[model samples]
Target: MNTTLQQAFGNIDIYLFDQLLKGRFDSCRNVLDAGCGGGRNLLYFLQNGFEVYGVDLHEQAIQNVQHLAQQLAPQLPPDYFQVAPVEDMPFPDNTFDLVICSAVLHFARDEAHFDAMVRSLWRVLAPGGYLLARLASTIGIEDRVESLGRGRYYLPDGSERYLVDEQTLLSYTQELGGELFEPIKTTNVQNLRCMTTWCAQKL
Candidate 1:
């Protein structure tokens, strides 16, 4: 990758990059990264004049993101990046035009924890806003994952993750009064693991 491109988008999720190419968030102003880690997914948003906010459970991660934000968007207040958990964000309801939870939901310890985190993300999104997420799932390699009970699974990749399926995502979309902005797509990595992209728009 070219240095300029790398600087513009620092290791951003490729699926999220696809949304940018489609101008899915062109009208968005306020953006929140629910589980931002060193703001890897935030460089483009910050440099492009988006009002960016981020939260992470790790204090050091928040500090790192704040530092990155300072370098990329000095005008933003330091409080824009905070130390918090996805299940309990500090922002008000319907606060952001775009809420990103990439590669984060799969860390849920169980079904309840996952539901709490999902609801919290949804609660902060404005009506008609977008929620973009990429998380591990048992989509194409169901048989390759061993159930640990309560939505947790041990996968062939030698890791444990709380995996969701197509039906689970669809159910949440319906229950949250959201619509799928893009059909759920999953990438199976050599039968070791799978990651699914879930893009939805709040109604």
Candidate 2:
């Protein structure tokens, strides 16, 4: 990704995460940025006063996170970064107050992978913690761009995403214990296409 695209994605993600973050977490405690790319979201969490742990499948993201943390806040060390998959996070169970899996789950190659990813996130989140996740849905404007081969769709990375709908999300919530569902909106498009955000909390 070029600087321009990276900036745009970063801005969009920050906006989305910020909206869901508000009023949900009362304290700046332990949080996990599952699939946190380059540790950027972890930086946001830290800047906002959260003790953050970043995990990603790619070694580069983990390395970038370490370097970024060293440069941005050298005082916060040791318990911060790891290279791991969302489906099988390396940390112990109930490790974080919040688990963030942004723009990553949709890349899962199948439903099992997606379900496992969600379950793993839920397992790590402490009671009252939340999963602030964003994905490419089939119900947003981006789907059109992606269908035409121009948008940021999770395809090349062995990722398979479903253009999820409201009922599907609701059903998933019901199937899993300890969660509430709140979907987020995107920029208005003539037709609702791919891309959506949702926040789920552990009860």
Candidate 3:
């Protein structure tokens, strides 16, 4: 990665970077990163004057994000970041224009937990808002994973995750009353694990 680019983007997910390139979030002002880990996906937004907030279960992660914000977006108050779970974010209803949950959903203990987190993310999103997520899925490596019951699976990579399939994601999109902002896409890493990008806009 170029030094200049790294300073600007700070390890943003490539798919999310693609969305940035496409101007998918050009009109979005308030952004919330649910389950933010060290604010890896937030550098660009913070630097560009977006009203950015974040929440994480880990206290250390929240502290790290606050430090990152202080360095890049000094105007933002420290309280903008909180230590909270994705399943129960502390924000008011329909507050943010963009909700980002990257590489976090796969840690769900079960289908119910996953649903709870998704609903929380949706609840805080304003009308016509975008929800961007990346999570482990059984899309391309369906045969390479063993079901552990309750939507959990043991992947060939020797890691366990609550993996969703293409149909499941599409069904959820419909259930959430959201339209696909972009076609659902997945990247397979050496057939070890598959990560899917689900970008949807609330109708």
| Candidate 3: 10-residue stretch with minimal lDDT | 1-10
Model 2 per-residue lDDT tens digits across residues 58-126: 888888878877765676674578878888988888778877778887676666777788888888888
Ranking by lDDT: 1, 3, 2
Whole-model alpha-carbon lDDT for candidate 3: 0.95
Clashes of 3: 0
Cα deviation at 122, candidate 2, in Å, is 0.6
Which 10 residues in a row give candidate 2 its minimum summed lDDT?
148-157
lDDT of 1 at 120: 98
Question: CA lDDT of each candidate?
Answer: 0.96, 0.67, 0.95
- TM-score (all chains, Cα) for each model: 0.98, 0.76, 0.98
All candidates in order of TM-score, best leading: 1, 3, 2
Cα RMSD (angstroms) for every candidate in the order listed: 0.8, 6.0, 0.9
Q: Write the per-residue lDDT of candidate 1 for residues 1-203, one digit (tens) a residue.
A: 59999988889999999999899999999999999999999989999999999999999999999999899899999999999899999999998999999989999999999999999999999999999999999999988899999999999989999999999999999999999999999999999999999999999
Which segments of candidate 1 are over 4 A away from where they belong? none
